[model samples]
Target: DTAVSQTPKYLVTQMGNDKSIKCEQNLGHDTMYWYKQDSKKFLKIMFSYNNKELIINETVPNRFSPKSPDKAHLNLHINSLELGDSAVYFCASSQDPSGRPPYNEQFFGPGTRLTVL
Candidate 1:
């Protein structure tokens, strides 16, 4: 059983198009994050959610939005996508850092590759 899963593993679309990637975690984690890996393979955190509340928002553009309807799910919606948006997006989950462990290793999902032309 996959601990974390993302839909539309491969997405190809034209510029200005809107797309969404859905993510879910069954590990019963309270924290989830969205990371983007560019063609250069530089992974950067885009957003983070803890217990259904937005905890971290990086320097991502307003065109990109992340929604967490519940602690188990985190979704990314991109509007007016551009060529620069082409990259691999990853969804990860981990126990809340405030807990006993102080730090928990994140469980990553199979990345979703988005290509904008």
Candidate 2:
């Protein structure tokens, strides 16, 4: 079984269009995240949800919304999609890290590539 899964691995749309990507994980992790990988291959975290609240990176635009209906699912919604929004988005999950014991690594999905025309 796949640890993480995303629907519509590839997305193509014109500028100003709206789209949404769905993601689900069965890893039993407490934290889920949304990451964006630019054309240059630079990956950066856009949002993180730790079982309850969401932590968003300040650099991310308001047009991008990440919704976590539950601990095992995270969905991304983009409004007024622009050329700059064209990139690969990844969903990742990780258990809570323990400084007193050990650390846990994050598991990411294959990625959803969005192309804006």
lDDT of candidates 1 onward, in order: 0.95, 0.86
Per-residue error for 84 in candidate 2, Å, reads 0.7
TM-score of each: 0.95, 0.92
Residue-level lDDT for 17 in candidate 2: 96
TM-score of 1: 0.95
For residues 86-111, what per-residue lDDT tens digits would candidate 2 score against the true structure?
Answer: 99999888886332324358889999
Cα lDDT tens digits, model 1, 1-117, are 989999989999999999999999999999999999998999999999999999889999999999999999999999999999999999999998453565578899999999999
Q: Which stretches of candidate 2 lie over 4 Å from their true place?
A: 97-101
Listed per model in order, the count of residue pairs whose N, CA or C atoms clash below 3 Å is 0, 0
Q: Against the true structure, whose lDDT is highest?
A: 1
Residue runs of model 1 more than 4 Å from their true location after superposition: 99-102
Q: Which residue pairs in candidate 2 collide?
A: none
Candidate 2, run of 10 with poorest lDDT: 95-104
